[model samples]
Target: MRAPYASDPATARGRRVPEDESSFRSCFQRDRDRIIHASAFRRLKHKTQVFVEHEGDYYRTRLTHSIEVAQVARTISGALHLNAELTEAVALAHDLGHPPFGHTGEDALEKMMAPYGGFDHNAQAIKIVTSLERHYAGFDGLNLTWETLEGIAKHNGPVTGDLPHALADYNALHDLELDTHASAEAQVAALSDDIAYNNHDLHDGLRAGLFSEDEIAALPMVGPAYAEVDRVHPGLDSYRRRHEALRRVFGVMVSDVIETSRALLDDAGATSVADIRHVGRPVIRFSDPVWAELREIRQFLFTRMYRAPSVMKIRAEVTEVVEELFVLFLGRPDLLPKHWARAVSAAGGDKLLLARMVSDYIAGMTDRFALQEHARLIGDG
Candidate 1:
């Protein structure tokens, strides 16, 4: 049997989402099915999570990341006795907001649209569910439940020191029912994102030779983890060859969350983000030691994988391409999509709306599309 918290109905603080299945799946599972079938989810296969979309045959694409998140969240949720359906749905849709080319595209577009309303993948994901991509109901978007929308927003939320989005700020309305339903699942999704990416990014970096097994072992808790990795699969660990190593890493993530939550259940009401606080992070979280190690690994990745000469060669080139293309499109102004000019909510008239619209459009483009457009307009034979 599942843990007893599966039926929890707390508040936005940490609660169980009510669900009723029709003939097959529970409501949240149905939501997951709809997301899986959506064009947006399919498009994620070709989108970026960290690296360029399609740049490497073995790199994790956005779709793989989403699937992995779902797996991690589901396992964690099960262990914690949270509603698995809600956890899985939240994990699957959390990154639906990210634009192509990962943060590279997100940043370029954010700058271009700063005048209108700075672009953000989270807000954009909400927009996609609420209004974009018209389908059968004569509605462009998916019409996801309010609970799902709230989970998407609170997944990572407005990071520290950042202003909230207009939607979040102006319509910060809190519906008790939706709040009660979204809390646990949202946390599961958020924590899963961290857990999945941290471990996988490390493995990916190691495979890329951005760092050696020995180098990673020298960083933070990486020594023991690297030893565990080697012990799990002692052979050469290439992206193509480390199949067993990859599975071991995934297993570590599942066990970490499960054991961490079980250990912290007594701290369910801790006071602060730093207070050795609540079990399960009130949403998605890990134990103190696990989190500390992940943080150090994150710092190391920034220095090794991201700032290395090889990755910089691509980042420098992509940064130029993204910024140049944004300027060109914003300069022309008329290239704005017809829907954007007409349907936008901004009252600053067509020009402002067009800029935001252009940013969204560019942000939405896949790495290949962005590159092709940039080359067509800026590159010479």
Candidate 2:
């Protein structure tokens, strides 16, 4: 049984483009299913998370990372008696806007499109569900429910400042209430993302030899987890040792969030999803100690893994690919895919509109496809 404050599908705000309810699925379940089947969702398979897609099979691609986030989200939401389906839907769709080479591609796209309204993955995600993912004959986008759209728009927190153009455009048509906290389920999904990425990056970095067990041994949560693994399994193989240690660290983080959130919810006394949203503070979060320790861990990964020499070299190369593709498409829209070219031509000589279309086309590419297109159009030699 869910808590009183849980988002009830019966009271859901409903989708922008109305449709008949499914007999077997809750509205949120249908949302999750639609997101799973989206072409953009499938493209995440080859998009990088930390390591490039071609680096190794063990590294987390965007698709794997999203799946992990969903797993964590469901676990947290289920424990909190929140809507696990809505949380999973948000988690799965969160990274759909991430371009070819993860953050590198996003940064490059932001730079290239600075004059045409900056690119933001969060806002791009909102755009994708509302206008870009044209799966239905009646609508341009998926026409997801309001709660899901709000979760996608402000899952990180309230958007009080100038919104991204993509988000702004949609908000004009149907306001997502960007200036308040999301549902508890959405809050759970957001924190779950933090838990998944921080833990997975440590595991991936260890496997990549970007950093050693010794390197992470001093970090908070890492130290105790490793010490326990060593105490229990002396002289274990490197693979098993790393796995055991990281799993312990992951457990600690998850436990911290759940315990902290439970206390916060009790204090807030929110009796409905609206009450949870308007409470003026997040109901889901890590404890103060855990948050600080996570900051240290993130700094370690940023310095030793994200900015390592090998990763930086690839970052530079992929940034160039994104920039060149953006400029090439802007200069010669005719070179875009036939369907994209038709869309550009239909813009009726609006360069800004053409640029935005090019941005969408380029942002949807997979890493391998982006590299191939770069070589094909700009030539590797």
Candidate 3:
């Protein structure tokens, strides 16, 4: 008989993953459904991947960003003969833990949560998927398929630390050899995140009139990337061209992922996407030369797009606003809505004490909800 789960060329493009005959679901489709039903996933509608609330009609929020990442991942998966379902799953749920107001909010929360567990969005993503999201499985959460969970666990595990306080510290994540040999499908999602944000941040900045296309085009890899788009769609010339330009960037990134994964799979004679990791080669991410170019692009975003005076002004205001809210809740117990005050007071611990209370309050917030609470306390709501 043919090897189990073997690819059939006929079902190649739009194949659903084989579930039991009674309940047909592909691996990626399962991921997508579980994510859609998860509380954290729904909250992404309000979280900031980049721009703040109500900034622009076209600027991407976290939900839109996740959808776009899925698109990029699926494109690569289709071309490379990898499982599209797995790619879509990875793309949809990647940013479930990001907070509002973007990095400024993340930093503010990190400072407060540091004594308990310094906040990192990647770590938080895993936490949300594994422990936090509730379901009736008596299993704590959605119990996503093992394959998807493994990728989420490794997606951005520390370059150094794998020491979850409860786990035996003996096994560092990098050394503990989990199957990080993600399908080209999964790898493309991670790379797609880089492509999506880098291009879109440029678009957002350009839209805000913070920078010009020519100026962004002068930056390292963006110069070539945007130029390729200009050439690809010669007739589209509105500032809206950024949208089409971004489409080309995704095309380039996906093409490379497909090419890299195919070469690795072909050389190893692997029977499936899961098996090609003969020696853990890096695939789907940028190759060495392009990686360095990406680093320069990241650096440019950090120095200019991120640090531009207008951006900094908004960041500062957001920081001050969140800080005041943090202080109010932690200092005067009565200021919190009665439930939180009772919840924190009943716990009676010094460790994460106030910060956990703060985290609970903040995590429960929608963008508008948080601001209204802030305004209410400040007498501005």
Better of 2 and 3 by TM-score: 2
Number of clashing pairs, model 1?
5
Candidate 1 clashing pairs? 132-140, 133-140, 134-140, 187-283, 187-284
Rank all candidate structures by their lDDT, best first, as comma-separated numbers. Answer: 2, 1, 3
Q: What is the TM-score of each candidate against the true structure?
A: 0.80, 0.98, 0.79
Ranking by TM-score: 2, 1, 3
Cα lDDT tens digits for candidate 3, 1-381: 322223332343321123332156654476678887888877777766556676666777788888878887777667665666776777888887666677788787777666765666655665566656667445555656655654554543213443332121212322323444554455667877877787677777777777777776787666676777778778676655776665565565556656665675566666654454333654565666666766876787787778888778878877766777777777665677775666677757554556655665675455656677787788543
Give candidate 2 misplaced runs (Cα > 4 Å): none
Give per-residue CA lDDT, model 2, range 110-153, as digits (tens).
Answer: 99888988899999998898888987999988888999988988
| Candidate 1 local distance difference test against the native | 0.65
Among all candidates shown, the one with the greatest lDDT: 2
Please give the RMSD to the true structure for each candidate, in Å: 5.1, 0.9, 5.5
How many residue pairs clash per model?
5, 0, 2
Clashing pairs in 3: 17-26, 28-85
Candidate 1 wrong stretches, greater than 4 Å: 1-23, 157-166, 169-182, 225-249, 263-266, 269-283, 336-349
CA lDDT scores, all candidates in order: 0.65, 0.92, 0.63
